[model samples]
Target: MTSEVSRRDFLKASAAGAGFVLTFRIAGGATSAAEAAGAWEPNTVFTIDPSGIITVHITKAEMGQGVGTALAQIVAEELEADWRDIRIDYPTSDPKYGLMLTGGSWSVNWTFDALSRAGAGARHLLIEAAAKHMNEPASECIAEGNRVRHLPSGKFLTYGDIVSKGLITATLSDEELKKIQLKKPAEYKVIGKWIQRLDVPEKTNGRAKFGIDRFLPGMVYAKVIYPPTRTGSKVVSVDDSEARKVKGYISTVREGDIVAVVAENYLAAVAAQGKMRVTWDKGPHANVTTDSITQDYWNKAKNDTSAPSWVDVGDADGALAKSMKTHEAAFWTDYVGHAPLEPMNCVARYQDGTFDFFSGSQFQTRAMGDLSKLFGVKPEQIRVHQQYLGGGFGRRLEPDVMLEAGLIAKAVGKPVKLIRSREDDIARDFYRSCTLQVLKGGIDSSGAVIAWKNTLVCAYPGERYGGLDKQGRDQFSLNGSDHYYDIPNQFVRAIRAETGMEVGYVRAVAPNYTFFAVETFVD
Candidate 1:
């Protein structure tokens, strides 16, 4: 769906800054304005204060990817602002931003054009404001060095000088913004030039705050006791008598299969959690293991015909049958965990039908919706304060930790900071799916690659979030199997195996394994 920032929401004077604010409400994938519009107070992409310091507010998660630096460069280049005057800031989750996420290598691809437009739009207004103050025609003025200079007179006004003189704020329509001229590649001064990363000094100097660095006043620590399997588990009983003997043990909370121990401090919580005795009815997946899941993938690849062909051209079976040189092999990839350095953690406070979440998240829009559904409140009632992530690697995209913190806080009637131990983090991870791929190829007598056939099987991760098409194929699982080579006879198919476990999108997701199989088979 396409959406543009409304004039009222796009540009205005910030109540606090007393300067112009510019915002761009660009399209973010399938999300539309109607589906995910949240409170838009001071919703802006960047702000130019009376001092002319440009603060760029980024919506994407910063998981050591340097995305903030890259995005700021895009804006600085188009705005013709001095690099020294630009600042980077990460804003909290707001639906007005639309589909706040940071994955799929989409940070730059999705925001480049829109951010450039935003920068150019602001530049146009600043130039006009400067020309008005200088009593010069806008056409003869050029923006450079964070100032507007009149060519003939050589008289210039700094952006700060123009703003301090009470510059008028104006809104640019989507059409007007599109008509503004953007700098050609040859004219780029800030984008390709070397600059110190804005986040480095803080990170290296121990001033940066990751989710794990959060410390809330009057908050307690909590730890969850995990189930043995991925699904179908229920907590039958909890004996916390011994846990109560711990110096600061508060209590035990059970919600469905999740059992958590709370205490005044993190060490006490861990100590008390170990003392408590809990029993779980490990459900249908009690016997499921990696070996069993891998075997199921192999079985499905060998026998399942209900799968749909992702690519089919010519007669691959006949070509392979007639070739004198043929090769066949199978490749397997086991389930892999995210294992981010910080583990999974969140600080959640639920009181009077409102919830506040403090954590790093790759998918804030969806997580807010999930929290709203769980708490039976409007989306506006939830606020997610974005924080730096030690590392995401596609693991923080899931909101399980945030949801768990919310559950514990609501049950305990106080703010809770939930921290998963390294063991629990790996054990309860939404792992990358196990996959098996069988490939066959034939070569002509002249050693020309002639035929190709491939079949892949896995429990579709997309099934967990409706990521599959009508044919029941997840493109995330079968990305590189469709070879780019012009093989006259080729076929590629995907089979869905029922392994009774959930899967998640890992870094590089399917291509990580798909390319490996295809490249090895080719070699």
Candidate 2:
């Protein structure tokens, strides 16, 4: 989806200073103007006040990836604003923020150009206003150091001076915005250079806020009693009389398989949770074990030729039969957890059909949608406050913690904060799928590889989230197996083993294991 900042209502006078706001206008799927008139507020990246204070609205989560610093640099490079004068703040979950996802290393790559243009657009307007005030040609004026200078006259005006004299508001049409010029690589001053991270000082000084650190007024601490089996488990009974006797214990809530103990404080919550007794009907997956999954995948890799072909070129069987030299090998990898530094935690307040959620989510937009579905409200009714993630590693992408917090708050009719213990975090994780791969290659008399055949058996990640694509294949399950080499005869196939466990993306996802197999086989 494409989005552009609407310049029509661009400049406004702020109590702090003369503020410039860039309203993001979504192209195709945006709500109509009439619908947005009352409910929608423009999405702005940066605002400059009369005091020269610049507030940059950071849209992505900071997961030790330097995304906040990199995005700020993009704006500073083109806005001609001093980096030290800029303040970075995480934005609330809004449609205008556009895709608040932070996985696959896409934060900088996707936003670099858009943020640069936003800065350049602000700089352009500042220069235009300065040129008019000085009665000089706009062409001869250049924006630098928060000031616009005339090359010939050597006279300049500070951003504050221009705003105080009179605010000039102008809007750029969609066509004009598209035609705006961007800086070349050689003109970049902030992007390529190393700037101290904006979050480093806060983190080092122990002032950074993570999901687990989230606290709100009147919020109670809660801990869930998750079933031994994460999926297909139901709560049969709950005995909370002993838990209620614990000091500071507020209530025990049971919904589906989750039994949460709520208390006045974290320690009290933990103590009460231990005292509560819960019985679970551990459905079909109770008998599934790691050893059984490993053996099943290995067996499938050897015998399941009924699996669909991921890639096929020429006749690999015929080529391997004719070749004099052939080598075959099999590799196995076990399931692994993301193991982020902080366990899953989320704070939620549900009142009068509105829910406020606080967490460091990698997929904020998707999480908002998930909450809306659970709460049975519009997406706008849910407000997600983003925070710093202790570590993501693809784990924070799931919204399970947020959902749990919301459910507990709704059940108790009060603000609730849910913190998962280390055991709960690991036990309930949708782990990386265990994989078994077999590779066979044929070499000619000249020692050149002629034929290659690969077979993969693994638990399906698609079954956990959205199912297979239209091609009826889980691309992530068979990723990195499509070789780029010029092999005339090659075949790649994948079989989905029923491991009775959920699978998810961890780090580089399936490619991490798939590439290892391909590289080791070739070597």
Candidate 3:
């Protein structure tokens, strides 16, 4: 069966307003990495009807990440249940589940314990209920292959028949709960064993529906109008009269101040949008060039001193002055964007005041909450179907695509599939933020770095961390120092650029720029 989470429902769950509580609990005894779903909670997985199917709601988004299958293994391994009879689905946009996303290689490692425990708890309840139905002592019953079998009579009951309304009606006492034994690593039949991906066959054969391929019953395709600049600029005037004259074009709507939504066939939409003449406010950034941006970084790094302390080994200042020699250098890196092959696309529909989104994303929960706030709806009302992403590398996780799709759909009253062309994607994209850095260091006679400091001495500043106050905001460093080797006394500092474009995540985040400064400068 397909997933039930709609786009609007997902957005709501993400924000976590209303009475929606996404509780998580760990089971009694299971060894796995911590799940992203906060503290673990039992009773996380439940069946809809007994004897129908076993469903586990996992938090991780699957973008060829193998999160769907791995999470099932967590459940089946712990429950010692039948793997063939189970199906895994995405959780609702609940605060508990929505924020629990699968990215940054944090999938199996994150949900291992919480999901296993949820499975183990469900497994135990099924076993106990089956034992009671068979008129046998639970002590004499063994749970295996979704059946709780009585040793003496070989009597058994399937999980479906054992559970009512998918609820664990038979609650184990605290003592009974403590006595519950989870499968050990040695007893594992599902996890820690070689297994094929469940969705790979469908994917390899072209049967899997990617986010770009998703469509609603009656959906119109739309294209975005991207200006050659960043967000927050105002649209002075847009002349869509010429665009409306195109053959396949239906209409052009000003979805956002700087965005125009054009609905038509692929070639027709491009032909139509190309004809539009738009004028902007030509804000302050209009005159700013990339060269000027890098220049700002140089000045900031030269004066930065407020770098946060990541680690401290010894007296870094004193050793640097006494060192046999000191060295310093400057470095620069050009900005880059993720530019995934599939680009960005979303299928959105709003009916009965609820939003439904079908897109590929790393943050299913975050999507719901962000949308709820954007649309002024309850989080639970948004349903998100996190389709298989073509490629993320962290790009599709942004709110821009999902929000725009929803707005276009809401405007048209028909489900709309919005996408970006290769050119449009790049022009409206965010990059790794170009940087210029200067490093200064001192090495002792023994050839060890004693004191090291690097500043964002370039045209632009680094991440504008919300935690820092206004005075502390502009001064930025991609990251603090990481002196891997032993240094008797060493420290690094951050200096912010006085001006430039906003800085954001690129690939490995701040570490890339920071590492270059420390490693290259220390020598």
- List candidate 2 stretches off by more than 4 Å: 1-43, 163-166, 462-467
lDDT of each residue in 1-523, candidate 2, tens digit only? 1112111211111121212234543322325442132221113677665556566778778989888888888888888988777778897788666556676666676666667767877777778878988899999999988789999999998765664554445545546655789989998888899789999999999999887788888999999887878578788899998999999999888776678999999999999989988888888888888777777777788787788999999999999998889999998888889889988889999988889889998877667666787667888888989989888988887888888899899999889998888988898887888788899999898888899999988766654344565556777778898977788899999787766666778877345899989999889
Tens digits of per-residue lDDT, candidate 1, 424-450, equal 898888888778899999999999888
Ordered by lDDT, highest first, the candidates read: 1, 2, 3
| RMSD, candidate 3, Å | 7.1
TM, every model:
0.90, 0.90, 0.82
Number of the predicted model whose lDDT against the real structure is largest: 1
Q: Please give the range of 10 consecutive residues that has the lowest summed lDDT in model 3.
A: 31-40
Candidate 3 lDDT over 268-383, as tens digits, reads 77787788888887666776776677655654565445644444457666766788998777788777777887888888898999998888876665576667877888887778
Ranking by TM-score: 1, 2, 3
lDDT (0 to 1) per candidate: 0.79, 0.77, 0.63
Candidate 2 structure, TM-score to reference: 0.90
Please estimate how well model 1 matches the true structure, expressed as its whole-model Cα lDDT. Answer: 0.79
> Global lDDT for candidate 2?
0.77
Model 2, residue 33: what's the lDDT?
42
Which residue pairs does candidate 1 place in steric collision? none
lDDT of 3: 0.63
